[model samples]
Target: MTDNFYMLTWNWLADSPLLAAATEVTTKSDGEEGTFVLAGVLLSLVIIYFASKLGGELCARINLPPVLGELVGGVLVGVSAFRLLVFPESGSLAEDSLIINLLQSTAGMPTEVASSVFASQSEVISLLSELGVIILLFEIGLESDLKELIRVGPIAAVVAVVGVVAPFVAGTLGLIYIFGTPVVPAIFAGAALTATSIGITAKVLAELGELGSEEGQIIIGAAVLDDILGIVVLAVVASLVKTGEIQISNIIYLVISAAVFLIGSILLGRLVSPLLVGLVNEMKTRGQVLLTGLVFAFVLSYIATAIHLEGILGAFAAGLILAETEKRKELEEQVVPLADFFVPIFFVCVGAQTDLSVLNPAVPSNREGLIIATFLIVVAILGKVITGFTVFGNPNLNKLAIGVGMIPRGEVGLVFAGVGSASGALSEATEAAIIVMVISTTFVAPPLLRLVFKETETATEAVDKVQE
Candidate 1:
């Protein structure tokens, strides 16, 4: 009766003359409107930003990576919990209005009402999040000296190959054999598991002040290579699923294209960068260096997209070239603020997209998802751990640390699952399973990384003490 009355009050308020007048006052003229929509987006970003800050600090207090907190913060406000940050849907007022606010504030409205408003602006937010990711990869590339990457090249290649191959075999066989899932879905599971979250690994290494360490360099290099391999594997699996037959030539072409895009970007960027940098150096305009760097990043990102590779690859390549510039330090310093603001948003949005309800055991399908998630997590960990042994450089370096660094699946795994879901190739249960696996990997990797690295530090100290 109380709920019904509340609903009645809301319905009445929604139709009230004063409320309509107030809404009209907020809307703009000249055929443009949606003041409330803009308010909602701003409110969403504010909420996300603070939540991410709180979450990150909390993780630091607990001796975990800050990204872990950011992700959890997203989950808290996302559909999994408070439903504060949501992707709005098109529907009747009732389905959209889960909460009602008489306060006439973006933060106070019905979740669905906000959703409806936000749905119209989702593309804008998505574009911003995409920019955040590009900046992140670019930062990682800037940190990576070409000479360091080249030094670790052989071991990184081996680690990447084994890392990808093991997980692919593990995830595919485990899903098909254990769960009796279809071939296409099993393939997706494998591809998803094979991804190494370079952002997570790089962040963790930087947090530990070990980004320049031998193990760290190997982990970063291997992760980049792993991403390249993962992309090819995904394309091949997707093609196989779509065509219902293996197209060897197409697979070869994709492989070549991806390789050429990565290698070609580096060579071409290096070759032409001096000319570009000289032009920018001559510019007397304010923020010339910053603007020129951004232009270069965006252009490379576009080229990567044209070749069907992820745009971040291009941004990363741009960073690699720019790292060699005389103004590299200035560029890094200038970009830091931009990275700080946007990177957390990307991670939080990732967490927000997770639907924990899918893990409910009471539902038969969700229970199946949970089971698959469990199996995939095991396979994901072991597969990466196996890759550590494949690395032959720096015998004193902790292979386990490298393995742990590679464990997080982050956004790339989500991309694989998303592509599968979007194509209608995966069933709901499979989709949920992949999501569970991705989230599980993400949540687990950070703490494990801290643990392994801490242990390595402790052992080193002990060895030094004994020698002393």
Candidate 2:
């Protein structure tokens, strides 16, 4: 039966009209050219979506955020773990490959074949991943109100400042003293530790339906501020790494540029939003609201990238402006489905980036990196937790929850470490340790947050009874 089927397949292929054309194409390219396969792309997406949903369902069963599950699912299918989506070893995907190798060693196909396949698709996959994040942030922005952000602005700023300063100082000193890292790489590590993955925190809060609460407001507000501060820190540190000297004027210029860009964008967005709403409302087309919202987001995202800020920031700002418009509810309803489809991809990609082999005690270097990572993780947790107690407003607020919310290092930390490694600022051991710290914080924070908020709810209920 098998032999007959094989003969039939070859005979069918030989008789096909495109057979001569196919042969000519193969002759021309000699198998060197890679073509994008639609079926493969679709299969990858289906696998990722299902794996993410399964991971999310598992986390939900344990009373954790679905975001946590999506992340774990990514790890399961990512190049580091199951090697589901392997990329090239060098050339275009060299950086992405390095990241995967740091987390887990590659296996399966020959390097040449794997590289060819990844090279053809990696750029598109990366762009899609970025779009996922953009939509995620835009949804977050829609859920948030400008008034709420402003209301918590002062406390958030205070929280952000303390969060940034505490982690930087402690992380730097700990790396230098405990890990025996040099000053520059230590600075890079410290800077990496200071990053708070606000996207993860926002998703967790939103999952709990606490996104509109005072504590949530404070956390989101602080996270936005934290992101700005992180950009500044990353810029300064990256500059120092590149130049081997800190130019005070250059630092000042970068800071001012970031501040101005954020402020200017928000101001401009607010001014133009009224006209945008009017224009969209005038359109008789179906889904005009959603289309306009996306266009607005994409334009701002483009402007942000042009100015060296993360595109997600622009997306968030666009959401904020749109949130103030009359079509806010309609926009939210329309954007949810789109967000659902894309958001899990971002989390899965994040998870797939993890390298668990680093924790294997059987490997000596892994053991050493694990030790350093363990110490750094402890520091990373404590430093953020310390920020919670420093909040002066709202004595009744859940400070612990706020701190726990800020704990996850997520993508931002990985990006920082990746840059440092690329520039030769961080040693292999140090880079490995940083990735461990990032993964640990991200993994533990969700459950820890649930535990913290559970206590907060209990305390609040007790207080309510006493008042009654």
Candidate 3:
């Protein structure tokens, strides 16, 4: 049956008129290329929007966070399930993508053109996804109280330190000792455990109307600090893996630059916000406030990326500074629609990149990784959870909520896995284990965060009523 099908497919392909013509046509006209690229992008966006909305709606109906639903929806339509939404980042070529295949079959887009279009379309969608998260962080920053965030800085610093250290040490040591894994691979896996996905947690907190709460502020602060520390750790680990020696100067440079980029941008943005206000007031144009806000955020985002730090941090700083202005209320209202459009793209893309088939123990090779993943998952959760308890002098704060908020590793963890795999620094089992850890935490943390926060809120309200 397989040989007969292959023979028939070859015969059909050999008889294609367009394929013969396209084979000789090495280049397409600029207009032709543009039209094809746009079509692919439009179709991909349709899939993204529909998947995100349907997933979000279903999740909302179940009283779960809508973001969780968007993620699951992406999984359903993405490589792991339907292959409807896929990306180049996961080692998938244009041929592996169903979207590209569909376009090629329907629109007569040739293989070479399809490949180019796929690359361009994926990069555009990825950029838009990046923009979505930056806007999300900016919105989160706007909602946050700078004064409160500053007040919790010392505690957050402590939490960040512990969060990074506990996971790195425990994961590395446990893997090496218990699993008999090699030193470098174990360290890389441990590095994967150290990421705290501020974007995911912040979005959840916003949805729950707890963005400005004490626990929320601590989680945000620690998470921001965690972001910086995680980058430095990743740099150190990647260097160590590549060169067999850590570069002290590079480590110091990353630390200094990240600190300077964040602190410097916030101070400068605050100083310039007055001018921003004046500029906005002078302009009598529609969308003046929105455009100005986005430009400022994008400029800072560009600066941060150029300086080797997270762009979202710059966007967040921009929001914090801009929130101090009298036009904050207006700006906040303006940014919401943009967030509504772009933010789900980031979440959905994250989900689409995730290949959940690795989790299936039905495959004999997966069982070992599954066993190792169980260990990493436990460590990843407990590692961050312990950080919340380390916060001193905040008795009324929901410590568990703060801990749970830090639980999701999300995309940051994925970076560690991707890097480890690319660098050949991790063994097959170790890579699978790290991926499983990330996938488990990324999906698990959302519901757990809501549960912890909800329980804390219920307890607080009950006590308030009793006191009243």
Error of 1 at 300 (Å): 0.7
TM-score of each: 0.88, 0.88, 0.93
Ranking of models by lDDT: 3, 2, 1
The reply for model 1, stretches above 4 Å from the true place, is 1-34, 88-116
Clash count, one per candidate? 2, 4, 0
Query: What's the lDDT for all of these models?
Result: 0.81, 0.82, 0.90
- In candidate 2, residue 127 scores what lDDT? 64
**In the order shown, what is each candidate's alpha-carbon RMSD?**
8.7, 8.8, 8.2
lDDT of each residue in 1-468, candidate 1, tens digit only: 999999999999998999998787656331132655565556668878988999999999988888889999989977788766655421123233222122144344444344445555455566778889899888877777877888888888899999999989988998898889998889888889899988877877878888878888889889988888888888887888788887788778778887888788889888888987899889999998888888899999998898888888888888888898887898888888989988887888888777788878888888878878888889999999888887664679799988888999988888898789877888878888888889888999999998999999999999999999
Off by over 4 Å in 2: 1-35, 88-114
Decide which is better by lDDT, 1 or 3: 3
Q: Estimate the overall C-alpha local distance difference test score of candidate 2.
A: 0.82
lDDT of 3 by residue, 142-199 (tens): 8888888888889999999999999999999999999999999989999999999999
